[model samples]
Target: VGKIPWWKEAVFYQVYPASFKDTNNDGWGDIPGLIAKIDYLHDLGVDCVWLSPMFESPQKDMGYDISDYQAVYSRYGTLSDVDNLIAACHARGMKLILDLVVNHTSDQHPWFQESRSSKTNPKRDWYMWKPARYDADGNRMPPTNWRSYFAGPTWTWDELTQEYYLHLYDTSQPDLNWENEECRKAIYNEAMRFWLDRGVDGFRIDTVNKYSKRTDFPDAPVTMPGETDQPAAEMWCNGPRIHEFIREMNEQVLAPYNAVSVGELSNTPLPSQVLPYVSAAAKELDMVFEFSTIRLGTGGPFHGKYLYREFPLSELKAYVATWQQWLEGTDGWHTVFCENHDNGRAVSRFGDDSTVELWEASAKTIALWQATLTGTIFLYQGQEIGMVNMPKEWPIEQEYKDVESLNFYGEAKASGDAERIRKTEKGLKILARDHSRIPMQWDASPNAGFTSAGVMPWMRVHDGFKDLNVEKQEGDDESVLRFYKKILKMRKEYSGLFVHGAFRPVLQEDETLFVYVKDDQGSEESGVQVNKRRKALVAMNFSGQPASLQEHDLDVAATLGCKHGEELLLVTTLKKNDFSRMEAGVLKPWESRVYLNF
Candidate 1:
C-alpha cells in the first residue's frame, strides 16, 4: 500500500510475442497487438512486461538468433511499434524489459558474415573461431568436445575461413568472443544504447554468464552419454572472466540509469557459484533467475525422459530456503518463477488436472508459493488463467515444431532405439513447444476470441478454451485470474512482509505440504501473530491423497502469528478438524489451500 521500490517488489508478465496477439492477421502475435493489450496487462496488476526477443531474425530460434540487435523483427512489427509500446507501458507506470541476446548472434548478422568472410577480416576475431584439427589421414575433427545446447558439436566448420566457430547453442548462433575487448564493448554499447535510447527500463539478459568462455575451450566432464553436443561445462557456462565482463558492462551501461536488470542464468550450482552473479557489489545483475525448479523432471539434455520426477515438499522448501538464505546474507536479489516461454505450464508439470476444482486449487497454490517468495515474480501469459501444458493428444507434428525437438526426434529414430524413441516422444509431447506457445484463449468464441476471422493460429489453443477462456474466468471471483489479481494486490499491500521479511520454513517435516512464514525485522512477533491470526499457513498437499498435518518441534511449525490454538490457519488437505487425528485427508491430487487465521 505504501511506496515500494520498483525493482524489489514488482510482478513481471512475460509476453511470448508470436502467441500474444495477431494484429495484422498474419497469424503471429505482433507489437501493435501487445500495445493494444497494454491495458490488459495493467489491469492484471503486473508492474512490468518482459517481451521475449523482438529483434530481427530468421525465427529459427524464435528471435533468439538475432540478426539485427537494434531493429524489430518484421514478423513482429516495425521500430515505431516498439517505441509505441514502450511509451504505452511507461505512460501506465509499467516498466518494459527487452531480451538482450549478447552471448551469440545470428549467422546472418553482418558481424558473423564478416567473420566468416576471410581469415584476415577485421571482424574475424570478434567471434570465437579456431582452425579444425585433422588427423594424418586428413580426417577433420572439431577443436574440442564441446556441445551446442541445441544438440551435436558446438563448433561448426566454415569453408571460407577453413576454421570452426563456437556456437554454444544452434550452429546458426555463433558465440561472440567476449574476451575481445572490442567485441565486448561493441555488444555492451549496442545492447545498452538500443533500449536506453528508447527509454526502456532494462534488459532481461539472455545467458549473461555464457558470454565468457575459457581461453582453452576445454571439454566438459561428460555428465550424460550422448549429450556431448552441449557446451563443455568448462568451455562455457560460468567461465573465468564472466564476473569481470559483467561488472565492466554494468559500470559502462547498466549502472548509469535506475534500471532493473535480471539475468537469465541457468545450469549453475547454488550457494557458492550462483550467488555472486546477483550480489549488489557485482553491479552486473539486479536479479538472477535460476532454472533448477523448472528443470526438475527433465533429464540429460533437457530433451531427455520426463522420468515422472517427484519433488518432495521438503526438497522444494530446502531449495527455496537456500536461495532465501543466500539472498538474505548477501547484497543480492532473486527472480522467481516456475513457468516461462521455454518451460511447460506449471500446473501440468507440478500438479494434476483431472478435475476443474483440483486444477484451480493447484494453480492457486502455485501462485501463493510464487507470490510469497522474496524475489521479483514472473507470471507468463495464460498462467493467470490456470493454463496447463498441452495434452499428449494434440497433433505430435504440430507440437514438435522447435528445431531442438525435431532434431532429437530424428536422432532417436535414426538410432533405432525403441526405448529412446518412446522417451523422446513422451518428453517432447509432455513438454513441447505447443505447451508454452499455445494461443491466448481470450474468450470462448471462435479461435478463443483471439481473432475475429477464420484463420489458423501459429499453434493450437487448448480445447478447454470453451470453458477456460478469459471471458468466463474474468468474471468468476474465484477464477485463477481473479485469484492472481488478489495475490498481486496482497503482495503490493504486504510488500514489506513479502519483500523484506526473513523467510523461515513452517512444518519442516511435512513432505506433502510446503509452508513458510516471513517475519519483518521488528515485526517478528507481530508477523507471527498476523500469520497465525490470518490462518497465514501456506500449505500444498503434494501427495495424491490428503496429508494429515503433524505437530512438530517449535522449529518445525515456526509460528509467525498468534500461537496456533483451536484451529490451524490453513489446511490444504480435507481432513478432520485436528490434523493429528492420523486420518488421511483428500487432496484430490495437487490441490492447495491457504487460510487466514485472523
Candidate 2:
C-alpha cells in the first residue's frame, strides 16, 4: 500500500540446484535442468529464485569453497548456461539471486594459492595468514586457540612455508582478510559485479557479519565439554567494524545497481544489534536471518551441529513475538523462515513426521503458520510438496554428504564409546544437512525424476518418493502443495492486512497452540475511513491431540470483527474445510486456520 520495495511483497524459493533435476543425466542437477522447471516455480507463486552455490568450486564445503568467483562449476554448466537461466527467470517476471560467499575462498583459489606461496607474494596479505607460534622451547602451536567450524584447529600448518594459515572452517576453505582494502575491492569487482552485471538481480550474502574480526585474534574462552578447541564466535561474530564494512559495500556495489540483498546473519541474535544492518536509513541490508530460535535444538553445549533436543513450540511465541513487535513501525524489516538448505525439513523439525498419515496434515499446519507471519516467504526445495526429512533408517555412509556430519561421526566412532557413537549416529540421521540436500521428488520415477534410472544420484533418494512425489499430489485438492497455493493466494488477496499491517501476539503463553492477530489497526488514524479497516487471525495447533481456545484471551464470536460468523477462507488440517463460524471450541490435532474480517 505504501512505498515498500518489490521484494517486501514477493515470495522467494531456494533451489539447491545439484538435487533439483538432472536433465543431462550427469548425476547432478544443472542449468538446463533449472530452465526446464521455470514454469513450475512460477506456478508455485514464486516471484524470486534463490539458487544455492553453483559457482566454480572444489566442493570441499559443497561449493562454499569457491575456487573461481566469476566462473560456473564445470559439472553444472558454462557461463552461457547461467545467462540463459537468468533470461528464463526474467521472462516470467521472476528475479534470480546468487549465493555470495566472499567471507572466504577455496585454499586452491588463485588468490589463496599465491597468498600461501613464499609468504611475500603480492597476494600474501590477501588472506588471514599468521606465523606459527612456538610454545616457549616446546612444540609449535596455532596463532590462536580457536576451533575450525568443521572440527579441527583454526590454524593449518602449510608445509611449504612452515607457517600457519587461519581458517574458520575446513582447512581447504581459508578465511579472507577484509582488513586489506585492495582485497576487498578485488572481491567486489570480480565476484559480486560479475553476476550483477549479467542480469542477476542480487545476492543472498553468506555469513554477512563475518567480514570483520578482532585484529588481535585472541584465544576463544568459550569451550564445550570434552573439546580440545574452542568456538571463537565472540572474537569474530558481529565484530566492532561489522557495520562499517556493510555500509561501504552498500555504497560501492549495491546502491549503484539498485539491487536488494538479504544477508545470512546466523550469529547476531538480538534485535537491537541487527538494526544497523537492516535499518533502511542506514542503507546496509534489506533484511537478515537471525538464528536464536533455529539454533536452540543444536549447537547448545555441543561444538558442532549435533542435535541436542527438539525445537520447542511452547517457546516459539516469545521468539517470534519479540522480532515482530520490536520492528513493527521502525526503519527495519523482518525475515520469517523455518527451513532452508542448511537445516532439516520444516515438517520433520517443527511438525509431526511420525506417520505417513500425519505428514500431510502437519505440513499443511506449518505452511499456514509460515503464510500468516508478516514477512517475505522463503520456501526451500521440496517444501511445497510437504517433503519430509530423509528416513532415519538410511545409513550415514550413503546419505551423509555434509562435512560437519562426517567429521562428528568419524571422531565419535574413533573414541570407541558405544553410547556416544549410537546417539551421534541417530542425531545426524535425523538432523543433518543431508535431509535437505536429497534429490527433489518430481515424480515416481526410479530416481525420483531427478536423474536416470540406473545412474545414481549424488545422494540416495528418500524412499517416500514412490508415493509422495509431485505427480501424485498435483491434482489432489487438499494436498500439501495445494494448501500452500491457497494460503499464498489469500495473502496476496488481502495484502492490505497481511503484508503491510501491524502484528500482535495473542495468548503468548500457550504451549501447544500458536495464535496471532494481524490487522490494519492504525489505518483510520493514518487518515483512512474507520469502516475500511481490516483484521485477521491465524491459529495453529502444534500437537497430535486436541487443543482448546482460550475464551478470555480470544472471544472469537463477539469481538473478532468478522462480517459473517467466521468468514473462514482456509482450514488446512480439516478434510472438508466447512467451518463458517468463529467460536470458542476445541481444535483437532495439527489443525491450522485463517479467519478474516474485511
Candidate 3:
C-alpha cells in the first residue's frame, strides 16, 4: 500500500509537566527536567511529545488561566529553556506540541485589565461584558441562567464597572469574545506566530469547540433537576460560528507552518457532530479528542463526572464501534487515549486493579487494544509503568489538589450532613482528577525519585509507587513497561496490517471477551486478490476467570478467507503455558493475545 502522514503513524506521549520530573529540586517539574528525560522518552518508542500548558499564568486552574501568551510560567522555566527543549526533541527525531489555551485568559491579563477599565475602552469588545438584569422586586440577577463548568453562575459580577463578565470556567478566567474580528486576528498573528517561529511542532488546542457563543445570551433549557444546575452545554459547545473560527485559525497560522492541530471537543453528542471540526475539506483541525467513550461509566448528565457507576462490556463496545464506523472513509481522524491529566488512571478506572497480577495483565490488555487501533495513540506520563489510582483511605483535605474537587467538597460541606459528605468522599475517590496528577514514579526511593527528599512534591505520590516504579520494571522482561515497548515496536514492524488496515469486530456477543480484527483484504490498491491478504486478530478477556473459545466460534476462515495460523505475536499472560494450547480455546483470566494470520 501507500505511505501515510507522519501524524497518522506517530505515537504521542502526553507529559503533565508538573508531575513529570523536577530538576531545580524545588519540588516542581521544570522544562530542564523534561529535557533531561528525552532519552527516556526516546527509548520508550514514542514519536512525539505533547506537553501540557507551561505558559505564564497565575495557575489558579493549574496553568489553564494564561496571563501572558509569550512568556513561560516562573515555575516551569524561561523562553530559553523552552527553546533548548525544542532543539533537544528535534535532535532526537521527536516532535513537540504545546497546549494552546486561547479560550480564556487569566483576569490579571493586560487585555482584560484594559477591557474592564471602562465601557468605551478600545478593548472593551474583546471580552464578554453585559449589564445585570433586575427583577420587579429590585433584585439583581445574572443576564442568563448559564452556569460555569467548575461551579456557580457563568457570569461574575465585577463591582468596579458594575458589569458582569462571562466565564465558562473559574470566575478568574473570563471567556474571550471571538465574535470580534480583531480578537481573532490578534490570536493568529501574535499568540500563534510567536510559537511557530520558535520551531515548535504544533498545538493541542484547549476548548477548541467552545470558541463561539450564542449572541442572544439566552437562558439554557434545563435538562434535569439538581441542586447545582449546569448550563446546557448544547447552548454553547460547538456553537454556531465555531467552524468558521477554526478555519480561520487553520488558514492563517497552522497551514502556513504545516503544523498538526487537534481540538479538545467536549459535550459532543455524536460522531457526526464532530466530523466538521476535523474534516480536511473543512480546513479545520487535523484531529479531535472526543470524550463519548470516556464518559461511559459515569452517571449520565445529571450527576457530575465524579459520580461513577458500573458499565457493561457490550455498551462499551458499541460506543467505540460507532466512532470507528463513522470515521472509516472520512478525512477526519480520531485520537485514542485512556488517561490524561483531567481523568483517573486507566488501570484503576477500567481495568481490574485489585491485585498486582491482575493490574499487570489488565494494563497490558488496554495497551494492546489502543496500539492496534487505526489512529494516533496518546500515552500519558506514568501510563507505561502501569500506574494506578491513589489510595481510597486518604481524606480529601490532605490529598486533593484540583480546584474542581475542592470546590465540590466545599459545596457538600455546607449541607451540614454526614451522609452527604461520605457520598461526596466516595465519589471523589472514584473519579477525582487528582488521581492522575500524582508524581511520576521513577524509583523506590522517597518521593518516588521524582524530587529530593528535602523538598515536598506539589501532590502526594501514590502509595503503591514502591512496587510499581520505572526503576524496578525497566529491566524486567515481564514488566508492563516492557510490554508497552514491545507493542509499540510491533506497530512499527507490522505497520501495514495494524496501522493501515480496516477494523472489524469479532465475537461481539460474548460477555467476557472483547475481540476484533484488523485485516487489509480485498483492497483495490493491493496487488494481491481478496484471498491473499494480511490480517491480525486481537482477542482480550475482560473478566477475572478463564474463558474458552473454539475455532468455529471465532470463524477466522469465514472472516479473513484464510485459516488461522500458529503465530502468536503478543500475549499478556503470567502463567507458564504452551502456545499450541491457545488453539484449544483456553484463555487465562485477563489474558490478551494478538495473532498474525497469513
Candidate 4:
C-alpha cells in the first residue's frame, strides 16, 4: 500500500473510437475526434485512456481483426494522427493504451496471407493449421467440434492449402500460434514495440488467455441441446504455457518501457486463476478485466448471451465479495467495471433505468459501488452521463451493428425455430454488445453530435439522446456526470481508504442492500485493525423499494469508533442521509451513501 503505482491511484476511461466523435463527417470517429476530447477526459480526472482496437482491419469484427498491427485503420486516421493523440494526452498528463489483439490477426494480414497461400510457406507455422477430419460418410469436417466465439466451427477450411485454420473468434480472424517461438518473437519484436516506440503508454491486451491453446485439439463435449458446435472454453483457456507466454511478453516489452498492461482474460472465472496474471510477484500483467462479472445476466451455454437470465441482487453481491475478499491480502489487481464496448450499460443493466429520475440515482449508486472497491475503476464513454441501452424497437440493421448480434439473428432465422428466434430477439433487447456500441450522445444536435447529419453513421444513434446527452448533464450539478466527478475527487482525497484499504463485506446475506467496509487503519503483517479510526463504509440499496441497513454481527459501529457518529461523504439521492433516517435505519430506494467510519 505504500508508494502505490500510478495506475492503482488513477481512474481509466475506455473510448470506443467509432462512436466517440466525427470531425471529418466521415460517419466514423477518428483519432482527431478523440484528440478533441482529451481535455474533457482529463477534466474528468481520467489518468489513463483504454482505447478499443483501432488497428488496420477489415472491420468484420469492429476492428478486433487486425490486418496490420503497426498501421492505423484508414477510416480512423494515419499513424501521424495517433502520434498527435499520444502527444495530446501526454500534454494533458494522461496515459493512452491501445487494444493489442495479438491472439489473432485478420485473414488479410500479410503473415496470414503468406501462411494461407501454401502449406510450405515459411510463415505457415505462424498460425494454427490442421488437416480436415472426415466423419462416417467421409464428409470433410472441421478439425474438431469446437465453436468460434462469434459462432460456427472453430476451424475454417482454406481452398488454397486444402487445410483448416483454427480461429477461436470470427472466420476472418485467425488465431496466432503462440507456442511457435519464432511467431512469439515476431509479435514481441515487431507489432508490440511499434506502438511502445511510438509513445503509447501501454496496451489493453485482447483475449489474453487464449494465446496458448492446447495442442491436442480435442473435440469439445456437447453441453447443450440443439447446438451445432461444442463449446471449447475449457480447452482453449488458461493453457499450460499461458504464464510463460505472458511473462515473456512482460519481460520483452512491458517491463522495458515500464508500460501499463491490462489483459482481457476469457474463461478465467475465479480470482485464483486470475491472480497469476496480475499479481506483482508474478511479473505478468498489471491488471486484468475478468468476464465473470459481465456474465451475470447471461443465459446458459449454446444460446450463450442471446437468452436472458434473471439477475439476482445477491448473486452480484457474491461476485463483488468473492473478487474483493479474494484479493485483499494479495498484490494482484483487477479492473472494476459494469459497461464496456462488449457489454450493456451499467445503469440499464444493474441500476434503475426505467425512468430518468430513477436512472440518475441508480447510476450514481452503481458508481458508488465501484468507487469504493479496492481495484481501479474504468468508466466507459457516455456512462458518466447515465446513457441507457438502445430502445428495443430499434431495428437490427439500423442500430445493432455488432457482428455477434447480426450472427445471432441470422442463425436464429435460418434455424426456423420460431420460438427460439422470438426469444433471441427478446434477449437481445435486454442485453447485447450493440447496446454499448450506440453512438456517444454528446448533445441534442443531429446524430447526437457524434457525426454530421449529412453523413450516415455506420450505426444509428440512440433516440434517447434528446434527453441524455453529455451536454445536457454538463451544466446540471445533480447529473450523473457531475456525481461521477464528485465521487472521483473523493476517491482521490481519501486514497488511503479507497485505494489501499482492506475490504470487508458486511451484511453478505442481505439481498436488498450492499454494505462494505474499507479499513485503512491496518498493516501488511497483521490484517485490518480498527486503530486510529480510518475506516469508511459504503452502503447501497439495490432495489426500487426503500430499505434499511440493520447493523449486523459485522459491527460497523464497533469496527469504526462509535462515538464520532458519521461523516456523510457521498450519496446518490438529493436528500442527504438525515439523522432521522439514520436513526430510523432506512436508506431511500436506490439510495447509496458513503460515510467515514468515524
Candidate 5:
C-alpha cells in the first residue's frame, strides 16, 4: 500500500476508442479526443483505465482482427498520440491498461499473407491449416465439425494449398497455430515487446482461452440448433496446454515487467482451471474476466420456446460467489464486471430503468456492489450515468459492425424462417451487441452530445440525452456520476477495507433485495463491532417494489458515504437521503443503503 496498488483498490474504466470521443469531426473518436478527457477521468476518481484495441486492423472485426501487431491505426492517430496519452495519464497519477488481441489476427496480416503465399513460405506454419476430407459425394469437407462463433463453418478451404484453415471467430480472423513454438514466440515478441517497450502498464488479453486446442482436431458437439460445423476450437478452448503456453508467454514477456494481465475467457470458466492462468507467481495473467454470470439463460431457439431466459438473481449471485470464494486466500485474482464493450448495458438487464429515479437508484446499487468486490472493478463508458440497453423495438440497421450479432441475424435468415429471427431479436434484447457498443452520451445536444460536426455516428446514442449527459451530470452533484466519483473516492480512502476485507452474504429471502456484507477479521457475530467493521455492509434492492427491514438491522452506522443523511453526499433524484418506514416502520420500496456500523 506504500506505493499504492491502484489496481487493487481503484476503479478501471473501459473506453471503446472508436466511440469514446471525436476530435477531427470525422464522426469517429480518436486518441486526441481521449486525451482531452483525461481530466474528466481524473475527476471521476478512477485510478486506472483499460482501453479496447486500437491497433492497425482491417476493421472487419472492429480492431480485434489485427492486421499489424505493433503499429497504431491511422484512424485512431499515430504512435505520438499514444505516447502523449500515456504521458498525460502518468502525470495525472492514473495507470493505463491496453487491450492485447493475441489470440488471432486479420487474415490479411503479413504473417498470414506470407503463410498463404506458398506451402514453403517461412511463415507457412504460422496458422492452423488442414487438408480437406472427401465427403460421400467426393466434395471437399472441412477438417472438423467445428462451427465458428460467428454463424457459419469454422474451416475455410484454401484453394492455394488444397487445405482448410481454422477460424474460430470470423473467417477473416484466422486462428494462430499455437502448437508451433515459433508462432507462439513470434506473437509474444510482437505484442509484448511493442507495448512494454512503449511503457504500457498491463494488458487485457482477448479470447486467451481460444489459443489452446486439442491436438487431434476433434469435432465439437453442436449446442446451437442446426449447427453442423464444429471447428477446432471446440476441442481446445481452455485445453490442457493452455497453462503451459500462458506460463511461457508470462515468463518471456509479462513477468519481467510486473504488468497486470486480464484474460477474456467466455463460457463460464471453472475456477480450478482459471486459477493457474491468473496465478500471482508471475507465470500467467493477473486476473481474468469470467463470463459465468452473463451467460446464464433458460434456453435458446434450438431448445423449445421459453427454454432460454434471463438469469434469476439467485443464479447470478451464486455464479459470482463461487469464483469470489475460491480466490479468497489464494494468490490468484479475479476481474469483476456487469458490462463491457462486448455486452449490453447492465442497467436495463439488472436495473429498473422504467423511471429516472428508479434507474438512478438501481444504477448506484450495482455500482456499490461492483466497487466493493475483491477483484478489479470495471465500469463501462455510459455505466457511470446508469445507461440502459437499447429498446428492441428500435430498428437497428444492417450497418452494425459487431460480427457476433450480425452472424446470429444471418443464421436466422439462412433458415428461411421468421421464428428463429424473432427469437434472435429477443435474444439480442436480453444479451447482444446493442447493450455494450452504444455511442457514448456526452451531452443533451445533437447525437446525444457525442458529436457536433453534423455527421452520422457509427452507432446511435441513447435517446434520453437531453437529460442524461456528462455536461448535465457534471453540474449536478446528485447525479449518478457524482455517486460513482464518491464511491471511487470512498474505496481509495478506505482502500484496506474494500481491497482485502472478507465478503459475507447478508442473506435475504427477497430476490429483488440483493444484499451482502464485507467485514474485517475478528468480529463475525456482532454486525456492529469495530475490529470486524471494515466497511461492514453492502446491499441493493433490485426489486421494484419498496423494500425495508422488519427490525433494527444491527444498528446501522455510516452509510458507506452514500447520500442518506440530512446533508446529501450523492443523489441522482431530487430527494437526498430521504427514506420512509414500511407498515412496521422498517426499510421500504427501492430502499438500498450500506453501513459500517460499530
Candidate 6:
C-alpha cells in the first residue's frame, strides 16, 4: 500500500467570497478581506481553502458566469489582491483552491461576443450553437426539450445568427464547446494554466460533469412529472466523452503542476457512475462531489430540490453507509460535506435550530460525524459558528438575490395560484441557496462586523448573529467553533486511522443511532508487514429525543480488541450532568461520542 495523498488527509474550508468578509467598507467580501482572515482559517484547523469563483463576471449568477477567466472581478479586487492572498495563505502553510467554472462562460465574454456576431464568425464554433427548429406556423422552437437547471428552456434563441445556444444554467452563462479541439487547448492554456502557473494549489471544478455533450444533439427523455417540456439532464450529464476530456486535462494541466482537482458531478445517480471520474487509475479527477447524501432529506428526486421535507434517520444512515461500502477498497475517494454554497445551512437542515441548546448539540453532532468519516471533510463559511437558515419572515423582494430563487419566485407569481406561491415561499425558506449566502457573522456590531456600520452587505445578515457570531463563540469552550476545532485536531492526531482505516457500520438497523467504526488492522506494503494498527468508534444520535443502547448493541468487547473497560472516551457532546446519564446507558438528544481502543 502506498502513502495516502495530502488532500485525502486534509480538511477543506469553503468560502463564498461575497459573504466571507468585507474590507474597505465595500459592502462585499474581497481578496483583501479574505487575506485578513488567513489566521482565522489557520486557527480553525482547516488545511485548504476552497474559494468560490472570483473572476470577472456580470454578477448574473453571483460570479458563476465568468466573462474573463484570467482576471479578478472588480467587486472582489484587482489581480494583485489575488496574488497577495495566495502568498498569504501559503505563508501560513495552507493551500488555496480556486473555483474553476469551465463548463460555461458569461455571454459577455469575448468568445461569446464574436461567436454571436454572425454565422460565419471564426469564433462561432467556440460555443454550442444549433439552427432553430421551426414550427408549422414558422415560429421558432428549441433544438431540444432540455431544460436549464434553473428552469425553462435550455436553449436561448439569437436573431443575429438565426441559431440557439445551450445553457444548462442561467442563460447568461453560455456552454462552451468542448468538441472543438482548439477551444479545449485555448481554454486549458488561458484559463487553467494562468492560475496553476501563478502558484495557486489546485481547483474545485464547477459543473465538471456537464463539459461533454452528445454530439448528435438529441432530445432528452422526460423523467419527472411537470418536466414534459423541460431539458432532461440524462442526455448530457457525464456525457460520453467526459472521461476522455478529463483524462486529457489531467495529462496536460493538473499532473504536471501536481495540483488536485475535485469535480462537481451533478445528476450522477449511482456511486459506480462517479468511479471513473475519481478513480486513481483513471487519471481524471482527484475526487468528485456527489449529492446523493445531501439530497437524502430533501424529498428524493420527485419532490425537487426546493421542496422541504423531513428525511428519516434510517434513510440518512443507509445513504451514508451505502457510499462508504461502495468505495471501501476502490481508488475512488469522497468529499464529505454537510453544507455548501448551493444549499441551506446544515445546522438548519440536519440539526434542530429551534433552540440554542438543540442547535449547538445538533450542529456539533453533525460536524463530528463528518470529521470522523473516511474522507476529506469540507466546512462551509460560518458553519463553525452554527449558522441557521434565513428568517422566513423576510420578504423575498428585499432579501433574496440568488438568480434561481428570483426565477422561481417570478414563475410562481405568474401562475396566479396563491397556494403554489405559498409553497414556493416555504421552499425558499428551507432550501434556497441564499440561505447560505448571508454575510459572515463576526460580532454583534450593527452589520454583525462583516462590514462598516453604514455600508450595507450584498445580502441581508442573519438576525441571530448576536449570539452566533464568531467573537462570542471564539472563547467559549462549549461553542460549536470549539467543538469543530477539537474534532479537526483529532483527525490530525489519528491521520493513519481516519484517513486509511477500513470503515464498518455498527448498529446498522438502529433507527435512532448512527454508529460506525474505523479499523486499521495493518497491511503488507512493499513485501514488508507494517505494524500500524488502531481502532475508533463513532456513535451519533440522530433524533431530538434521548436514546439508549445495550452493551450488546455496540459489541465493544469484541470489536475493541481489548476489555470493554479499556475503552477511552475520546470526545462527546454531553456535559457533566449529561455524562452521568450517559454512564447509565442513556444518550441525550442529538448527542455524539467517539471512543478509542488503545
Q: Cα-based RMSD of the predictions, in order?
A: 4.1, 2.5, 2.4, 2.5, 4.3, 2.1
TM-score of each: 0.91, 0.95, 0.95, 0.95, 0.91, 0.96
Q: Between which residue pairs do clashes occur in model 6?
A: 146-231, 147-231
Q: List the residue pairs that clash in candidate 3.
A: none
In model 2, which runs have C-alpha deviations exceeding 4 angstroms? Answer: 299-304, 522-531, 550-553, 558-571, 577-584
Clashes of each: 18, 0, 0, 0, 26, 2
Q: Write the per-residue lDDT of candidate 3 for residues 96-135, one digit (tens) a residue.
A: 9999999899999898999999999999999999999998
Best by lDDT: 6
lDDT of each: 0.75, 0.82, 0.82, 0.83, 0.72, 0.84
- lDDT of candidate 6 over 1-598, digit per residue (tens): 4655788878899999999899988899988999999999999998899999999999999999999999999989998998898999899889999999988999999999999998889889999999888789998789987877777788999988788998988999999999889899988998899999999999999989988888787876766556545547776788989989998999999999999898888789698898989888899999888887777546433225566677777777888888766776677777788789988888888889998889989999988888887677888999888899999898998999999988878877886989868887888888888999999999999899999899988998888888889999897888899888988998778765665566788887777888888776422211223355678888788788887757435665456677867878788987656665565355678998888886
Error of 4 at 20 (Å): 0.3
In candidate 6, position 542 carries an lDDT of 79
Local error of candidate 3 at residue 203 (angstroms): 0.5
Question: Candidate 1: misplaced stretches above 4 Å?
Answer: 1-4, 222-231, 302-310, 522-536, 550-558, 561-598
Q: Which candidate order results from sorting by lDDT in descending order?
A: 6, 4, 3, 2, 1, 5
lDDT of 4 by residue, 1-598 (tens): 2455788878999999998988899899988999998988888889999889888999999999989888889888999999999999898888999998899999999999999989899999999999998989999988888977777888999998899999988899999999899999999867788889989989889999989888998888888656769888887899989999999999988999999999988688887898999888999999899877777788853446688888778888888788777776677877788889887888888887887768878988987887877778888998888889888788776668888888888888888989979888988887888988878999989999999887888778887888988888888877888888888888887766776667888777887888888877433323323246477878788888777555444344554555534544444454443444554356777887777754
